[model samples]
Target chain A: MPNYPKGERRRAEILEAAFDAFGTVGYRNASMVQIAADCGVSRAGLLHHFPTKESLLEAVLKQRDRIDNEQFFAGGTSDDGLDYLTRMVRLVEHNAAHPGIVSLFAVLSSEASDPGHPAHVYFQERYARSRSWLRRAFRDLEQRGMLRPHVQPDGLDVEFLSLLDGLQVQWLLQPDAVDMPARVRAFLSRVLTEVA
Target chain B: MPNYPKGERRRAEILEAAFDAFGTVGYRNASMVQIAADCGVSRAGLLHHFPTKESLLEAVLKQRDRIDNEQFFAGGTSDDGLDYLTRMVRLVEHNAAHPGIVSLFAVLSSEASDPGHPAHVYFQERYARSRSWLRRAFRDLEQRGMLRPHVQPDGLDVEFLSLLDGLQVQWLLQPDAVDMPARVRAFLSRVLTEVA
Candidate 1:
């Protein structure tokens, strides 16, 4: 009974198919015709929403960021480092449930290391933003006297981000061998101590 | 000049060009014709040495592994954990001088996460072998009473490998912002204490 724009609905459907195609065989291997077919639309129909493959990829990445931000940070309850750590654990747990998206992210981000890559700027800013967020969380915890006295928030932020990424790659490669959430928790415990 | 097989010399030249091509644009984007052009050979001549692109990639990876093992572990002077840690720092320092290979590794390894990726098996075994190597080093340190009493070699191995990989990605993304060797050294000192 709810009214939604049919064009908008179709755009979402096209993006979904695009995500699947790009994530499975990767960008270079994915074809517009194939993605259109997957979406049950003609190639021109898909192009009406996304003029080019690059534009579609950008839209997909933006959508991914929006969904992640909503799911992980929108609760507004992360008052300190401990809360942030908890959210990270939850995010990893979430990632385990969705390997395809994670694979897409890993592959795209890695590919974007090339300065000429289409998503290079996007990924660069993404890492910078993530680092800043972690830095602020650590800063808040330090203000509240939760961090170990020797821990510098900036350095810890960098190290924590590295561990998060590194652990994800390992988990993706050998899912049965790694418990990502547990690893994150162990890292958190090693670096941060809760105030009594 | 020292006597060398003409075929062996030509093969080496071809591999050097292959490395340059693959490391610059990645595996999928690099063409045999471009690689042959770089080597100043005909495409048919290049194919004579490496029957396929996949074979060339495999050879490039193997060559990379050989150089890394030689530079980092050939001396066999890593008698204890501290020695092994020092070697790791040195390797990172060496890596700073060669960003191309590092970028290639970051891209290919991420791409290889897909089971269908040609290099997937190669990367999986590489990680396994690296983990085993680190485990032995940690185990040796444990035997020498170098590791913190609470730290188990197996867990430390996983953590160290994670940190190593994580740091590499960060360094590749923002080389000017990270001191890779210093980060490795700091992590080492935090986990292992010198026996007095």
Candidate 2:
């Protein structure tokens, strides 16, 4: 059904190897040689599939995004924002397990905002979309009497999103101490408890 | 009373200029030449006091620690943990005014965890010290009955710290959308009324 079937599989294989390499060793330290060795392929073959380190890094980040969305959102169960908290905890748990991925996101997100950085546009778009979705979810919670009447509708979204972003930084810093999912759960539980 | 009056002044001036430069241009992009120009000094003169860019960056971060301590906990108000929220808001507001400084810290902090990174040890120590201080403060709040009787004693510190760190990431990403101080204030208000 596909032209260049072997090529596609080869590309996917190389990308997987690179992901593992970068996740463990980090973006700066992970090299083409290491990736090729991990894949049991020649260095030239690895480059033939993905020509440059930047290209490989971008591929890994892109793959991560799709995987992350699938893992967290999973496309259903959007009755209230409670799922968001549970999903957030699951995300943190995943990050804790794959500390390398956490490290990659932390190292790159800041530079990604630079406009010229490789992942600049990707990070910006991801952030914008994520923020919009989060705000919409909070608004739904408010409408469904899931939030306090005193919670300013105009400002509620920002509070939720800020707490979410803030906790990620902390979790990345000390995964052993900061259970991101649990903290979100507590805050969300409080939100529900305070609702009108 | 101090020796090298002019030298001290020049060094201070350079650090200030460099701070502004790094904040605006980022650590990687802001060059010593531009920093020298910003301070009305020759590039070599700028280097005479601080030999390397890394050293200058370290000085800037150290300056931030000094300023943060002075403004946030002046007269050692951290004696009670509740007041820390007010200081935290103040810190957030200060950062909003200087987005570059926000970027600087966010950028360095991300790198600060990598053992081989220049600022790694500094950040690691900072996290340890900060966690200890916050844990004691939360414990004090519990002792004063500022928190509910059943509130988990040790975990609140991690939660509070996570909130602080997580909020900053959101603030930087969508500065227009996030009223950091107000968001933090709301979180504190909720925590005080509900848990405290």
Candidate 3:
């Protein structure tokens, strides 16, 4: 009734613009008016799609997660430990190719570390979900005797996640000095034998 | 010339206030006027000391680095690898107790990842210096055969720093769930046969 397809396309464009804005200057510093201008939409039109900056931020984060899932879990969440680690390497490789995506998460994740931040709960839940899945993968590795003798699965999930998150900042700051996929592979090999 | 000691005291107070503000709202969002107000200093007075926000940021970073060096290198930079690692653990323990300090770094280091950010060059040089020193430490360990058989010195410096930096975000987001020092110790123990 209201040109639904055109509306959807416009909405997608707004999301893309907001993602770049948020990634570049971060959410607090990013302006709605500027974002609207970036996407060639009026302020009212931008607000029509995203009622508030918070809503836009939410949409961008959701889009990011959706892309990550679609890319890595296309086969419906691999249960094999090796498959999971291999996918993680691919994900890091994918991230290296897209500095904007890495910058978005790196910026927002730290910015949202404040308890009062709008995305605080979002990041907390995201990390919890990541840790849970990683724990399952580590358990699978333990079952197959792939984890090294010194490798403890108890806090390994958080450590591994930290490694990935940490590597991103270094890679972003000094791209030539850090090879994200290589470092991730090195970490995985250190903890687990026969890393694929 | 005019109340030099008092001027120094006020500068210190301003630094403390800016550190807290920067940690809470990040550098881009932190307002100079608000920081001046927090320290009960007039805008002119604040400007008199720092001249610009960038200058204040530089001073705060220098203060942080000075504190770290004083606490860790009282003996003029330990040459022993075990002592260096032990000091690192102590540093992490110290950081866990100081959430504000950790927050300041976690927020700024990522925020400054943007090439145009004021502290961009500072963070780049800081990481370079850290990697160089860490590389030396690893080399010392390799020479003494303290590093495990599987441990490769190459890229280990960046990986270690990444683990530390990455762990800060998780710890800040969910402090109760993350034991920073413990996770650091675990990573160290995994790589080295004996961790002090």
Q: Which candidate is the best by lDDT?
A: 3
Residue lDDT tens for model 1, B56-144: 99999999988888998767774565677778778878887888767778777777787877898888887788777788888887887
When only the first chain is scored, the TM-scores of the models are 0.89, 0.75, 0.95
Better structure of 1 and 3 per lDDT: 3
lDDT of 3 by residue, B1-196 (tens): 2456898989999999999999988999999999999999999999999999999999998998988888788666768877888898899999899999899999999999999999999999999999998888889888999888998879889999999999999999999989999999988887787876
- Report the Cα lDDT for residue B159, model 1: 69
lDDT of each residue in A84-183, candidate 3, tens digit only: 8889888888889999999999999999999899999999999999999888988999999999988888898999999999999998899999988888
Q: What value does the lDDT take at residue B29 in candidate 1?
A: 68
Which candidate leads in TM-score? Answer: 3
- Candidate 2 local lDDT, A1-196, one digit each (tens): 3365887877888888877665433455567887888777888888897889999988889888887888887666665665665576677667667666676676666645454556666766776677677677777777777775445555555566555555555666566767766666666655664321
Model 2, span B1-196: residue lDDT tens: 2466898988999998887765543565568888998889887888899999999989998998987787777657647676665567778778778776677777667655555567667776787788788777767776777754334555556666656665556666656666767766666655554321
Which clashing pairs does model 3 show?
Answer: none
lDDT of 1: 0.76
Error of 2 at A23 (Å): 6.9
How would you encode candidate 1's per-residue C-alpha lDDT over A56-121 as one tens digit per residue?
999999988877777788578745667877787788788878887777787777667777778878
Off by more than 4 A, model 2: A1-6, A13-58, A73-79, A115-118, A148-156, A194-196, B1-6, B13-47, B52-54, B75-78, B148-153, B194-196
